[model samples]
Target: MAAEDPSVSGVSGRYATALFELARDERSIDAVKADLDQFEAMLADSADLKRLVRSPVFSADTQLKALAAVLEQAGITGISANFLKVVTANRRLFAVTGVIRAFRALVAKFKGEATADVTVAETLSDKNLDVLKAALKSVTGKDVALNVKVDRSIIGGLVVKLGSRMVDSSLRTKLNSIKHAMKEAG
Candidate 1:
Protein backbone atom coordinates (compact mmCIF):
# COMPACT_ATOMS: atom_id res chain seq x y z
CA MET A 1 0.00 0.00 0.00
CA ALA A 2 2.96 2.28 0.64
CA ALA A 3 5.72 3.11 -1.81
CA GLU A 4 8.96 1.32 -1.17
CA ASP A 5 11.17 3.28 1.20
CA PRO A 6 14.19 4.83 -0.50
CA SER A 7 16.22 3.66 2.47
CA VAL A 8 15.72 0.07 1.26
CA SER A 9 18.74 0.21 -1.02
CA GLY A 10 20.46 -2.51 -3.13
CA VAL A 11 19.21 -4.37 -6.19
CA SER A 12 17.42 -7.13 -4.31
CA GLY A 13 15.71 -4.81 -1.87
CA ARG A 14 14.59 -2.43 -4.59
CA TYR A 15 13.24 -5.20 -6.78
CA ALA A 16 11.56 -6.94 -3.84
CA THR A 17 9.92 -3.73 -2.71
CA ALA A 18 8.61 -3.09 -6.19
CA LEU A 19 7.25 -6.63 -6.45
CA PHE A 20 5.69 -6.44 -3.01
CA GLU A 21 3.96 -3.20 -3.86
CA LEU A 22 2.65 -4.67 -7.07
CA ALA A 23 1.36 -7.77 -5.32
CA ARG A 24 -0.28 -5.68 -2.62
CA ASP A 25 -2.05 -3.54 -5.18
CA GLU A 26 -3.22 -6.60 -7.06
CA ARG A 27 -4.44 -8.23 -3.81
CA SER A 28 -2.17 -11.17 -4.57
CA ILE A 29 0.19 -10.86 -1.65
CA ASP A 30 -0.62 -14.25 -0.15
CA ALA A 31 -0.47 -16.00 -3.50
CA VAL A 32 2.84 -14.39 -4.33
CA LYS A 33 4.22 -15.32 -0.93
CA ALA A 34 3.26 -18.96 -1.45
CA ASP A 35 4.85 -18.97 -4.89
CA LEU A 36 8.05 -17.47 -3.60
CA ASP A 37 8.19 -20.01 -0.78
CA GLN A 38 7.76 -22.88 -3.22
CA PHE A 39 10.45 -21.45 -5.47
CA GLU A 40 12.81 -20.99 -2.55
CA ALA A 41 12.28 -24.61 -1.56
CA MET A 42 13.04 -25.65 -5.13
CA LEU A 43 16.23 -23.65 -5.06
CA ALA A 44 17.29 -25.30 -1.84
CA ASP A 45 16.43 -28.81 -3.03
CA SER A 46 17.88 -28.74 -6.54
CA ALA A 47 21.55 -28.13 -7.22
CA ASP A 48 20.86 -27.58 -10.94
CA LEU A 49 18.30 -24.86 -10.27
CA LYS A 50 20.64 -23.18 -7.79
CA ARG A 51 23.44 -23.28 -10.35
CA LEU A 52 21.17 -21.91 -13.06
CA VAL A 53 20.27 -18.97 -10.90
CA ARG A 54 23.84 -18.28 -9.72
CA SER A 55 25.89 -19.04 -12.86
CA PRO A 56 26.72 -16.22 -15.24
CA VAL A 57 27.24 -18.49 -18.22
CA PHE A 58 23.55 -18.48 -19.06
CA SER A 59 22.31 -15.64 -21.22
CA ALA A 60 19.28 -13.62 -20.23
CA ASP A 61 17.17 -15.24 -22.91
CA THR A 62 18.19 -18.73 -21.77
CA GLN A 63 17.46 -17.93 -18.17
CA LEU A 64 14.09 -16.48 -19.02
CA LYS A 65 13.09 -19.52 -21.00
CA ALA A 66 14.29 -22.01 -18.43
CA LEU A 67 12.75 -20.11 -15.56
CA ALA A 68 9.44 -19.75 -17.33
CA ALA A 69 9.22 -23.49 -17.77
CA VAL A 70 10.17 -24.10 -14.22
CA LEU A 71 7.56 -21.69 -12.91
CA GLU A 72 4.89 -23.14 -15.10
CA GLN A 73 5.80 -26.63 -13.99
CA ALA A 74 5.61 -25.52 -10.41
CA GLY A 75 2.15 -23.98 -10.99
CA ILE A 76 3.32 -20.52 -10.08
CA THR A 77 1.35 -17.93 -11.97
CA GLY A 78 -0.12 -14.44 -11.73
CA ILE A 79 1.90 -11.59 -10.26
CA SER A 80 4.59 -13.82 -8.80
CA ALA A 81 5.32 -15.49 -12.13
CA ASN A 82 5.40 -12.15 -13.94
CA PHE A 83 7.64 -10.58 -11.32
CA LEU A 84 10.09 -13.47 -11.54
CA LYS A 85 10.13 -13.27 -15.33
CA VAL A 86 10.92 -9.60 -15.11
CA VAL A 87 13.79 -10.38 -12.72
CA THR A 88 15.22 -12.87 -15.20
CA ALA A 89 14.83 -10.46 -18.11
CA ASN A 90 16.57 -7.76 -16.15
CA ARG A 91 19.51 -10.11 -15.50
CA ARG A 92 18.89 -10.16 -11.77
CA LEU A 93 17.98 -13.83 -11.44
CA PHE A 94 21.03 -14.50 -9.30
CA ALA A 95 19.47 -12.37 -6.57
CA VAL A 96 16.03 -13.94 -6.61
CA THR A 97 16.44 -15.60 -3.23
CA GLY A 98 17.52 -12.35 -1.63
CA VAL A 99 14.62 -10.57 -3.27
CA ILE A 100 12.16 -13.14 -1.96
CA ARG A 101 13.61 -12.77 1.53
CA ALA A 102 13.33 -9.00 1.35
CA PHE A 103 9.78 -9.27 0.09
CA ARG A 104 8.89 -11.60 2.97
CA ALA A 105 10.41 -9.20 5.46
CA LEU A 106 8.32 -6.41 4.00
CA VAL A 107 5.21 -8.53 4.23
CA ALA A 108 5.92 -9.49 7.82
CA LYS A 109 6.55 -5.87 8.74
CA PHE A 110 3.34 -4.85 7.07
CA LYS A 111 1.46 -7.52 8.98
CA GLY A 112 2.92 -6.33 12.28
CA GLU A 113 4.73 -9.64 12.74
CA ALA A 114 8.28 -10.52 13.69
CA THR A 115 10.63 -13.04 12.17
CA ALA A 116 13.36 -14.95 13.93
CA ASP A 117 16.21 -16.81 12.28
CA VAL A 118 16.61 -19.87 14.48
CA THR A 119 19.58 -22.14 13.97
CA VAL A 120 19.61 -25.43 15.85
CA ALA A 121 22.07 -28.30 15.93
CA GLU A 122 19.36 -30.57 14.59
CA THR A 123 16.02 -30.26 12.86
CA LEU A 124 13.37 -29.42 15.42
CA SER A 125 10.25 -31.49 15.82
CA ASP A 126 6.96 -29.81 14.96
CA LYS A 127 6.01 -29.66 18.64
CA ASN A 128 9.34 -28.12 19.60
CA LEU A 129 9.09 -25.62 16.76
CA ASP A 130 5.60 -24.59 17.94
CA VAL A 131 6.90 -24.13 21.49
CA LEU A 132 9.81 -22.04 20.24
CA LYS A 133 7.55 -19.91 18.08
CA ALA A 134 5.21 -19.36 21.03
CA ALA A 135 8.12 -18.37 23.23
CA LEU A 136 9.40 -15.94 20.64
CA LYS A 137 5.94 -14.51 20.19
CA SER A 138 5.68 -13.91 23.90
CA VAL A 139 9.04 -12.17 23.94
CA THR A 140 8.41 -9.98 20.91
CA GLY A 141 4.75 -9.26 21.64
CA LYS A 142 4.04 -10.02 18.00
CA ASP A 143 3.27 -13.07 15.95
CA VAL A 144 6.66 -14.64 15.34
CA ALA A 145 7.61 -16.47 12.21
CA LEU A 146 10.68 -18.64 12.30
CA ASN A 147 13.20 -19.20 9.57
CA VAL A 148 14.68 -22.39 10.86
CA LYS A 149 18.07 -23.78 9.92
CA VAL A 150 20.00 -26.80 11.09
CA ASP A 151 23.73 -26.63 11.68
CA ARG A 152 25.23 -29.80 13.06
CA SER A 153 28.47 -27.99 13.74
CA ILE A 154 26.73 -26.27 16.65
CA ILE A 155 26.78 -29.67 18.40
CA GLY A 156 23.81 -28.60 20.55
CA GLY A 157 21.61 -25.72 21.61
CA LEU A 158 20.01 -22.96 19.55
CA VAL A 159 21.05 -19.65 18.05
CA VAL A 160 18.24 -17.15 17.56
CA LYS A 161 18.44 -13.96 15.62
CA LEU A 162 15.53 -11.59 16.12
CA GLY A 163 15.91 -8.36 14.24
CA SER A 164 19.25 -6.81 15.31
CA ARG A 165 19.45 -8.90 18.44
CA MET A 166 21.12 -12.32 18.47
CA VAL A 167 21.25 -14.95 21.19
CA ASP A 168 24.05 -17.45 20.63
CA SER A 169 23.59 -20.34 23.02
CA SER A 170 25.23 -22.99 20.91
CA LEU A 171 27.61 -25.51 22.47
CA ARG A 172 30.32 -24.42 20.03
CA THR A 173 30.16 -20.83 21.25
CA LYS A 174 30.17 -21.87 24.91
CA LEU A 175 33.13 -24.17 24.32
CA ASN A 176 35.02 -21.44 22.49
CA SER A 177 34.38 -19.01 25.32
CA ILE A 178 35.56 -21.53 27.89
CA LYS A 179 38.68 -22.24 25.84
CA HIS A 180 39.44 -18.53 25.65
CA ALA A 181 38.90 -18.15 29.37
CA MET A 182 41.18 -21.14 30.09
CA LYS A 183 43.93 -19.65 27.90
CA GLU A 184 43.59 -16.29 29.66
CA ALA A 185 43.83 -17.98 33.04
CA GLY A 186 46.91 -19.99 31.98
Candidate 2:
Protein backbone atom coordinates (compact mmCIF):
# COMPACT_ATOMS: atom_id res chain seq x y z
CA MET A 1 0.00 0.00 0.00
CA ALA A 2 2.89 2.39 0.65
CA ALA A 3 4.07 1.75 -2.91
CA GLU A 4 0.70 2.97 -4.20
CA ASP A 5 1.14 6.33 -2.46
CA PRO A 6 3.47 8.80 -4.13
CA SER A 7 3.88 10.71 -0.88
CA VAL A 8 4.87 7.53 0.92
CA SER A 9 7.58 6.40 -1.48
CA GLY A 10 11.37 6.23 -1.06
CA VAL A 11 13.32 6.59 2.20
CA SER A 12 10.65 8.23 4.32
CA GLY A 13 8.12 5.61 3.25
CA ARG A 14 10.52 2.80 4.10
CA TYR A 15 11.11 4.13 7.63
CA ALA A 16 7.42 4.84 8.16
CA THR A 17 6.47 1.35 6.99
CA ALA A 18 8.92 -0.28 9.38
CA LEU A 19 7.73 1.87 12.27
CA PHE A 20 4.09 1.16 11.47
CA GLU A 21 4.71 -2.58 11.37
CA LEU A 22 6.56 -2.44 14.67
CA ALA A 23 3.76 -0.47 16.28
CA ARG A 24 1.17 -2.92 14.98
CA ASP A 25 3.10 -5.92 16.22
CA GLU A 26 3.27 -4.33 19.69
CA ARG A 27 -0.37 -3.19 19.53
CA SER A 28 0.76 0.37 20.36
CA ILE A 29 -0.30 2.10 17.21
CA ASP A 30 -2.31 4.84 18.94
CA ALA A 31 0.45 5.62 21.44
CA VAL A 32 3.09 5.81 18.73
CA LYS A 33 0.86 7.98 16.58
CA ALA A 34 0.24 10.40 19.42
CA ASP A 35 3.94 10.67 20.18
CA LEU A 36 4.82 11.26 16.53
CA ASP A 37 2.08 13.87 16.28
CA GLN A 38 3.50 15.66 19.33
CA PHE A 39 7.00 15.57 17.87
CA GLU A 40 5.76 16.88 14.54
CA ALA A 41 3.92 19.68 16.34
CA MET A 42 7.13 20.56 18.18
CA LEU A 43 9.02 20.64 14.91
CA ALA A 44 6.47 23.02 13.50
CA ASP A 45 6.49 25.25 16.55
CA SER A 46 10.24 25.43 17.21
CA ALA A 47 12.73 26.85 14.76
CA ASP A 48 15.62 25.47 16.81
CA LEU A 49 14.20 21.96 16.73
CA LYS A 50 13.56 22.25 13.00
CA ARG A 51 17.13 23.38 12.52
CA LEU A 52 18.41 20.48 14.60
CA VAL A 53 16.42 18.03 12.50
CA ARG A 54 17.19 19.55 9.13
CA SER A 55 20.70 20.91 9.45
CA PRO A 56 23.67 18.81 8.43
CA VAL A 57 25.88 20.83 10.77
CA PHE A 58 24.66 18.92 13.79
CA SER A 59 26.66 15.81 14.60
CA ALA A 60 24.76 12.61 15.32
CA ASP A 61 25.84 12.75 18.95
CA THR A 62 24.65 16.32 19.33
CA GLN A 63 21.32 15.59 17.71
CA LEU A 64 20.84 12.45 19.75
CA LYS A 65 21.55 14.27 23.00
CA ALA A 66 19.25 17.17 22.12
CA LEU A 67 16.53 14.84 20.90
CA ALA A 68 16.77 12.73 24.04
CA ALA A 69 16.20 15.80 26.16
CA VAL A 70 13.31 16.96 24.02
CA LEU A 71 11.60 13.57 23.98
CA GLU A 72 12.05 13.09 27.71
CA GLN A 73 10.66 16.56 28.39
CA ALA A 74 7.78 15.87 26.02
CA GLY A 75 7.11 12.51 27.71
CA ILE A 76 7.69 10.48 24.53
CA THR A 77 8.83 6.94 25.26
CA GLY A 78 8.60 3.35 24.09
CA ILE A 79 8.55 2.54 20.39
CA SER A 80 8.17 6.13 19.24
CA ALA A 81 11.28 7.28 21.10
CA ASN A 82 13.26 4.28 19.96
CA PHE A 83 12.21 4.78 16.35
CA LEU A 84 13.19 8.44 16.50
CA LYS A 85 16.57 7.68 18.05
CA VAL A 86 17.21 5.04 15.41
CA VAL A 87 16.40 7.49 12.64
CA THR A 88 18.68 10.10 14.21
CA ALA A 89 21.49 7.58 14.54
CA ASN A 90 21.03 6.69 10.89
CA ARG A 91 21.31 10.41 10.02
CA ARG A 92 17.87 10.48 8.43
CA LEU A 93 16.45 13.08 10.80
CA PHE A 94 16.17 15.54 7.92
CA ALA A 95 13.34 13.45 6.54
CA VAL A 96 11.53 12.95 9.85
CA THR A 97 8.62 15.18 8.81
CA GLY A 98 7.99 13.10 5.71
CA VAL A 99 8.34 9.93 7.76
CA ILE A 100 5.75 11.17 10.26
CA ARG A 101 3.36 12.11 7.46
CA ALA A 102 3.74 8.73 5.78
CA PHE A 103 3.18 7.00 9.12
CA ARG A 104 -0.03 8.99 9.51
CA ALA A 105 -1.16 7.91 6.05
CA LEU A 106 -0.48 4.26 6.87
CA VAL A 107 -2.37 4.55 10.16
CA ALA A 108 -5.32 6.17 8.40
CA LYS A 109 -5.36 3.35 5.87
CA PHE A 110 -5.23 0.72 8.57
CA LYS A 111 -8.03 2.38 10.56
CA GLY A 112 -10.22 2.90 7.48
CA GLU A 113 -10.12 6.65 7.95
CA ALA A 114 -9.87 9.33 5.29
CA THR A 115 -7.32 12.09 5.93
CA ALA A 116 -8.08 15.58 4.71
CA ASP A 117 -5.62 18.47 4.51
CA VAL A 118 -7.54 21.57 5.41
CA THR A 119 -6.29 25.17 5.07
CA VAL A 120 -8.23 27.88 6.81
CA ALA A 121 -7.81 31.65 7.13
CA GLU A 122 -7.51 31.28 10.90
CA THR A 123 -7.57 28.73 13.68
CA LEU A 124 -10.87 26.91 13.91
CA SER A 125 -12.88 26.47 17.07
CA ASP A 126 -13.46 22.90 18.32
CA LYS A 127 -17.12 23.14 17.33
CA ASN A 128 -16.20 24.14 13.78
CA LEU A 129 -13.67 21.33 13.62
CA ASP A 130 -16.28 18.78 14.72
CA VAL A 131 -18.72 20.14 12.14
CA LEU A 132 -16.12 19.86 9.41
CA LYS A 133 -15.27 16.33 10.43
CA ALA A 134 -18.94 15.35 10.39
CA ALA A 135 -19.41 16.80 6.92
CA LEU A 136 -16.30 15.03 5.60
CA LYS A 137 -17.41 11.76 7.21
CA SER A 138 -20.78 12.03 5.50
CA VAL A 139 -19.14 12.53 2.12
CA THR A 140 -16.37 9.95 2.41
CA GLY A 141 -18.46 7.33 4.26
CA LYS A 142 -15.49 6.80 6.55
CA ASP A 143 -14.14 8.42 9.68
CA VAL A 144 -12.36 11.61 8.58
CA ALA A 145 -9.18 12.89 10.15
CA LEU A 146 -8.34 16.50 9.48
CA ASN A 147 -4.88 18.03 9.21
CA VAL A 148 -5.72 21.66 9.62
CA LYS A 149 -3.41 24.56 8.77
CA VAL A 150 -3.98 28.23 9.32
CA ASP A 151 -2.95 30.46 6.44
CA ARG A 152 -3.86 34.10 6.70
CA SER A 153 -3.21 34.50 2.99
CA ILE A 154 -6.48 32.68 2.32
CA ILE A 155 -8.24 35.81 3.65
CA GLY A 156 -11.42 33.85 4.52
CA GLY A 157 -13.19 30.53 4.11
CA LEU A 158 -11.27 27.27 3.80
CA VAL A 159 -9.66 24.87 1.37
CA VAL A 160 -9.92 21.10 1.72
CA LYS A 161 -7.83 18.48 -0.01
CA LEU A 162 -9.07 14.90 0.22
CA GLY A 163 -6.92 12.47 -1.70
CA SER A 164 -6.62 13.73 -5.26
CA ARG A 165 -9.57 16.11 -5.03
CA MET A 166 -9.24 19.71 -3.78
CA VAL A 167 -12.01 22.18 -3.03
CA ASP A 168 -10.96 25.83 -2.71
CA SER A 169 -13.49 28.29 -1.37
CA SER A 170 -11.20 30.99 0.01
CA LEU A 171 -12.11 34.65 -0.39
CA ARG A 172 -8.79 35.16 -2.17
CA THR A 173 -9.71 32.61 -4.82
CA LYS A 174 -13.27 33.93 -5.24
CA LEU A 175 -11.97 37.47 -5.68
CA ASN A 176 -9.43 36.31 -8.20
CA SER A 177 -12.15 34.54 -10.16
CA ILE A 178 -14.32 37.70 -10.16
CA LYS A 179 -11.34 39.78 -11.30
CA HIS A 180 -10.66 37.36 -14.14
CA ALA A 181 -14.31 37.34 -15.21
CA MET A 182 -14.46 41.14 -15.26
CA LYS A 183 -11.27 41.29 -17.33
CA GLU A 184 -12.75 38.84 -19.86
CA ALA A 185 -15.94 41.00 -20.11
CA GLY A 186 -13.88 44.04 -21.08
The candidate that wins on TM-score is: 2
Instruction: Give a tens-digit lDDT track for model 1, residues 58-86.
Output: 99999999999999999999888999999
Q: Which segments of model 1 are wrong by more than 4 Å? A: 1-7
Which candidate has the highest lDDT of all? 2
Q: Show model 2 residue runs off by greater than 4 Å.
A: none
The C-alpha local distance difference test score for the whole of candidate 2 amounts to 0.96
Tens-digit lDDT track of model 2 for 1-186 = 779878788999999999999999999999999999999999989999999999999999999999999999999999999999999999999999999999999999999999999999999999999999999999999999888888999999999999999999999999999999999999
Pick out the ten consecutive residues of candidate 2 with the lowest summed lDDT: 1-10
Q: What TM-score, over all chains together, does every model reach?
A: 0.91, 0.96
User: Count of backbone clashes for each model?
Assistant: 0, 0
- Would you list the C-alpha lDDT of every candidate in the order shown? 0.89, 0.96
